[model samples]
Target: MRKKLLHIICLASMILLFSCSGDVTDELPALTRAQLSINLLNNGDVDQQEEINSIRFIVFGSTPGGVRLDVNEHILLSTPETATDIDAQLLKVTSSNDILVVVIANEPQSLTSKLDGIASHWTLQDMLYDISDILNSDGQIISTTGMPMIGVVRGISIAPDETQKVEMVIERAVARVDVFLEAIDGGAVTGYTAGSTSVTLHNLSHDSYFVMGNVGNGTRDNADSSKNYGKVKENVPEIDLLTDTWTAATSDTWAYSSATGAKNRRLLCSFYTAERIFKSDYSDRLAVSMAYVPKGPSDVTGITEKVIETITKVDDKGSPTAQPFTEIRRNNVYQITARVGKIGIQILTVTVEDWGDRQDIDLDMDL
Candidate 1:
């Protein structure tokens, strides 16, 4: 009888223990779901809007254990549909700590597969891209594929069953350069027109990372051929204007003729380049090559000249200065204003400003 009573007590103890275990399990938090509404702030410009062909949205969460991902989605815009805003459902959100949200726009199709490897383990800086894939053979961002852009939101608290509306500003990963030729006092040289001028960007890297940083030199594909400028005109002497004899700048392109006598500072050409930041040294920095005709007196035969001048910095008056210009940030516009002065003297102004804001950095080339 005593053994029977002891067995009954043992069974009772087992029942109570399981009941306590169930209570403890119930006290722990359960994974929940939330919703996210992403509103991409954009200008209504059609050209800018066309750059956004698709978008990839990702959410990452961290805990004492390890990293976790609640969402990974890529959406392609339909015909004539510019995705200015988006809505996504968040799954398996822990809500214990803040989460990180990343959005990338107009990435290559191959990136879709690469992103899968990063879903479980990733960092913001680990997201790198080869610049060649983003640029065309002419070293310009491909309009059909669209320009690359990114936006990140961190420390976002997503409560369970609550919809969070977030506003993000996405910026391009490339820089745009607009060239303007303005005819200043033609100096002693007569018939010197701003026409027959060509600009070339030199010392550019063939490959760079799309990710923004203080320095862009990282692992490159090494096969890229965009190291120099694009569509350079033939018969343009590569010799230095300061040291070599003068040659006339000539091009069959109609734009060359239209640039002449641009006293009103008409747009010459627009091109794009990868981002760059040079803190102290400017050797690896991008440089501009301006080739134009330096007109002499009409009566003087064989006095007309063409020369290529390379400039690295600009002064307050927009002339190339000895001081080094440091950086070329992404999504910024470098407006070059070339002012023709006396023969062999040209002043150039390089105005650096955000794409959204217009500023002047005039480059006056007085030749």
Candidate 2:
């Protein structure tokens, strides 16, 4: 009995397939979304409100050799006049193998609001493409070329007052590919230290390009040589007769100086903003040194023009140094010494704008 029923169904299908007189066939796929016309009833009426009454769809004939053909169908509707429609309608579809038939219906009584708002209306073709995975559940394969291929269509229109109908057809398949970001070579860096001595910073990132240094000193004095009036030879001022001095004048030098081989004494530093130092392409090692000072204030003002008219002194020719001491090179470290004067010892201090961890440096000198 089961075999007999299967035979009967097969005969009926064959008859249906050959019954068509014209080119149109039941086997042919439906039209694409772009080809159909979708209209909303009473489109601009405030009171009635627009909606979809029913949908009308048509399927076209297939190409030779069972190849699918491309068809255009219409998909959505909008108010059209209010604003230039910049909104784009997108539909995503997937299939196990190939789609065969697709059916769509309104979500039971789900209707659009009367007020102005974004509304999406899907046509028969649009619905089919959106659910291609379900249609092709059986894994039935169909020739895509020349035969109807799946695709989506979009349109803009206003809401109608009464129930509306959307018509569409399915056709040629549309393919979309995905895109992303790739990295390139980092950037260039020219480093420099403020005063002298090459400073090395670990884990330096690409962003740390500028460097600076700060150096300073301090001093203290404790000596009394007065009222002796040259009475004793031991109390006589050894260096200068007019100035009072202690017997240990030659033995103890009052000059203030940085401790020998002190790393903090001659600072080597570099600077960079937080943003640049943390960049992805920064290097772990940094070698920076000070470069010559460019056109400074003195260069702009024509001061210290030329002592001798014929020959131009290279060092002091164009401009005198702006600051008391300008950093000549990074490799050269300054050994600052403070001499004791009549009053007392003097302290020296230095600060650089963009340097490493330390902001400023201070040194004590015995004057």
Question: Each prediction's TM-score against the native?
Answer: 0.63, 0.12
On residues 266-309, what C-alpha lDDT tens digit does candidate 2 reach at each position? 11122221111112222211212112211121111111111101
Model 2 segments more than 4 A misplaced: 1-49, 52-59, 67-69, 72-367
Of candidate 2, the 10-residue stretch with the lowest lDDT total is: 1-10
Alpha-carbon runs more than 4 Å astray in model 1:
1-29, 45-48, 83-96, 120-124, 161-163, 186-197, 211-263, 294-324, 342-345, 358-367
Number of the top candidate by TM-score?
A: 1
Candidate 1 per-residue lDDT, tens place, 196-303, comes to 444565544323344332111211222443221111111212231111111223332111223456333545565565555543434454455555433344322111
lDDT, each prediction: 0.46, 0.19
The CA-based lDDT of model 1 is what? Answer: 0.46
Instruction: Tell me the alpha-carbon RMSD of every candidate.
Output: 18.2, 37.3
